[model samples]
Target: MAIENRNICSLYDDEKENLLLLHSAELLENISQSKEKYRKIIQAGMAQWVKGLQEGRIKLDTVADLKLLIELDIQLQKDEEI
Candidate 1:
């Protein structure tokens, strides 16, 4: 005589559906929490932008984007006597 044993570890169809719903709720909650965090980050960034503008450290309209800023800074640094 021989004895065989097997173990199954799978969610049934209904259980899988319930898990999906729970996962979706968790994701939504995460996004909702992150929204406020993103808003604070944006606010801080805007303040920095305004300060840069006041100091004439950042010229926005003339330069298209960050690439120009980086290039110009590099050139200025290279022009130093050092």
Candidate 2:
């Protein structure tokens, strides 16, 4: 037997609105958690990068690369404001 998809339009307006609200809340929660996870990962990676630089394990020779990293960090900071 083939599974059939139900038409959302068949739902009453209030029911549709409730469903949409529930879905939106779930999506927002997922987005929030994902952002937090990525933020922690980025922070850890940055700490390791800095440690490597300090310990002479990594060498950055170009001003452009350093500038780019600085710009990216700045953008991440701005994102936190939202």
Candidate 3:
């Protein structure tokens, strides 16, 4: 009976580890897809900003705001690295 209990516990532990690994893999995949989507969105926004700049629709203040946003992003990346 004791041997049977030990085997059951071991089986449960193995299943738990497998579940954790599966969950991690799925989470990583979702994050990767989200990052790609965000990248495309950012690119599209930048292109629009450039177009507005060339057509004299976007103002200098708007450019300054964009610079601030880039600086914030850089700061955030540095924070994450730390």
Candidate 4:
């Protein structure tokens, strides 16, 4: 639903709710946990991708899309210590 241009209160209320969530510890922790889970999933995918490459299921010349997965894995690994 669109907020009415004349309804300043609606905008103010939405901003206040966003600020509350920003300061919520539960929300922050949940976000951190979700990121770690997603990182693990991507790592698993990378492992399988390597297996495919070794078994000749994946082609060396058809690695353009794999480059994107590698980039994302690298970016996430930069944040993950273990």
Candidate 5:
């Protein structure tokens, strides 16, 4: 009976490990997708900001939020290095 119980525990452990691996893969995929999504969105925002600034639609000193977005873009680049 003890041997049978040990085998069952071992089976459960293998299953757990396999599930963990699968979930890890899924998590990495989601992270990659999110990074790409943010990269595109940020790039588009920066382009629009440049266009607005050039067209006299935006005052650089009044848009602190855009500065925050620029910081986020910098952070994203740092993350890619890791």
Candidate 6:
């Protein structure tokens, strides 16, 4: 028996990726509003972001969030060493 591998890159084109981009933009817009009133909405957006990454709804390739997370992790490690 032979096993086949399918790459996610081949699954989504520029159009589908644009929808994900739009969703992310909307989330950011919601985040920028008054947190006092939109607290739950902001938190829900963040929760969904994490959930999407874990569940493979969002792909990490060339993504800024992943890069920022890595940089923050490095900064935390450095702070811990001080």
Of the candidates shown, which would achieve the greatest TM-score relative to the real structure? Answer: 5
- What is the per-residue lDDT of model 3 for residues 7-77, given as tens digits with 9 covering 90 to 100? 53566777879878999999877876765665566566667778888899998778875675466545545
**lDDT tens digits, residues 1-82, model 6?**
9865456555557756887899998976665453334444445555666788899988877367655555554554464454
List per-prediction Cα lDDT, in the order shown.
0.62, 0.74, 0.69, 0.77, 0.83, 0.62
Q: Can you write out model 4's per-residue Cα lDDT over 1-82, one digit (the tens) per residue?
A: 9756755465677787876877796876787798788878878887888899999999899787678778877876776563
- Tens digit of per-residue lDDT, candidate 5, span 1-82: 3455445356677787987899999998898789889988998998888888999999878577678779988998888777
Identify the candidate with maximal lDDT: 5
Residue pairs in steric clash, candidate 3?
Answer: none
Where model 5 places Cα greater than 4 Å from the true spot, the runs are 1-10
Weakest 10 consecutive residues, lDDT, candidate 6? 33-42
TM-score-best of 1 and 5:
5
Instruction: Give the range where candidate 3 is weakest over 10 consecutive residues by summed lDDT.
Output: 1-10
lDDT of candidate 2 vs native? 0.74
Worst 10 residues of 4 by lDDT: 2-11
Work out how many backbone clashes candidate 4 has: 0
Off by over 4 Å in 2: 1-9, 62-82
**Tens-digit lDDT string for candidate 2 (1-82):** 9966578977788989999999999987887687677667666667777887899887887445545555666676687677
Give the Cα error of residue 66 in candidate 3, in Å. Answer: 2.7
Question: Candidate 3: what lDDT?
Answer: 0.69
Rank order (by lDDT, best first):
5, 4, 2, 3, 6, 1
TM-scores for every predicted model: 0.48, 0.67, 0.66, 0.59, 0.74, 0.32
How well does candidate 5 score on lDDT at residue 63? 77
Higher-TM-score candidate of 4 and 6: 4
